[model samples]
Target: MALEIHNITFDCADSRGLATFWAGLLGWNVYYDDDPEVVVAPSYPNPGMGLLFIPVPEGKTAKNRVHLDVAPDEGTRDEAVERAVAAGATVTGDHRKDDGTGWVTLLDPEGNEFCIERGAAERGPRTSTAYRIG
Candidate 1:
């Protein structure tokens, strides 16, 4: 038997609010907005993985050990970063190089870190050393 990923859960202060932020950024819809938990994902048929926001009493205190890296389906990374900022995300780090490589790190409304990478159009073609981590 093989196991599949259900959802990526997030512990937050306001589940609905955080879910809204993510939904807007990803162009996904909010499926569940009930108390205790809020879920956001691609409409219908389910996209295999969704974001689950659960309310918690405690607040985020440090950098997240695990973070999501997203790439735009259309437009440039700068455009995606702008959209994220307009939707309540804060830019934490700018790692874009002069040669049009790298990504931008951002913090969601609840301070959870996520990154925005070059879009498909911007990336063009994948190379052997495209994602080499130093």
Candidate 2:
């Protein structure tokens, strides 16, 4: 018997401004706001999986069947998509590639969508080779 994944809600109209834009883009902290809901996390007994932001009336029409693909543990990936467009986010899609691999589709700030790969020191080291199923 095992089942986890405490939070990951987000159905927002402004639950403390999308939990302060995802607690300043994952620096996570907002333990909990008010007015409906808003509870980011990365500490305080956080065993991983947290980010609530409720309060939904009706918005974000269509798109986003399930998203959130960030990858910058530090930098790169166009500087984390220019720090997520200077923390307001909105570059609907860019799918960077030309030998740099791809990923860069942001939206946040109430638009939803997410994605901005290329971390792990900007995807260096890992000659590649993986296909196992036994």
Task: For each of the candidates, give the backbone clash count.
Answer: 0, 0
Per-prediction TM-score to the true structure, in the order listed: 0.91, 0.36
RMSD (CA, angstroms), candidate 1: 3.5
Instruction: Tell me, by lDDT, which candidate is best.
Output: 1
Candidate 1, residue 64: the lDDT equals 97
Top model by TM-score, which number? 1
Scored against the true structure, residue 124 in model 2 reaches a CA lDDT of 80
**What local distance difference test score does each model get?**
0.92, 0.83
Off by over 4 Å in 2: 1-35, 45-52, 61-69, 74-94, 106-111, 123-134
TM-score of 2: 0.36
Query: What's the true lDDT of residue 110 in model 1?
Result: 96
Residue-by-residue lDDT tens digits, candidate 2, 1-134? 66898988888787887887778887878865345787888888744888787886898788989988978788788987898799899997797879999998988888889898898897888898999875
After superposition, candidate 1 runs with Cα above 4 Å error = 45-47, 129-134
The lowest-lDDT stretch of 10 consecutive residues in candidate 2 is 29-38
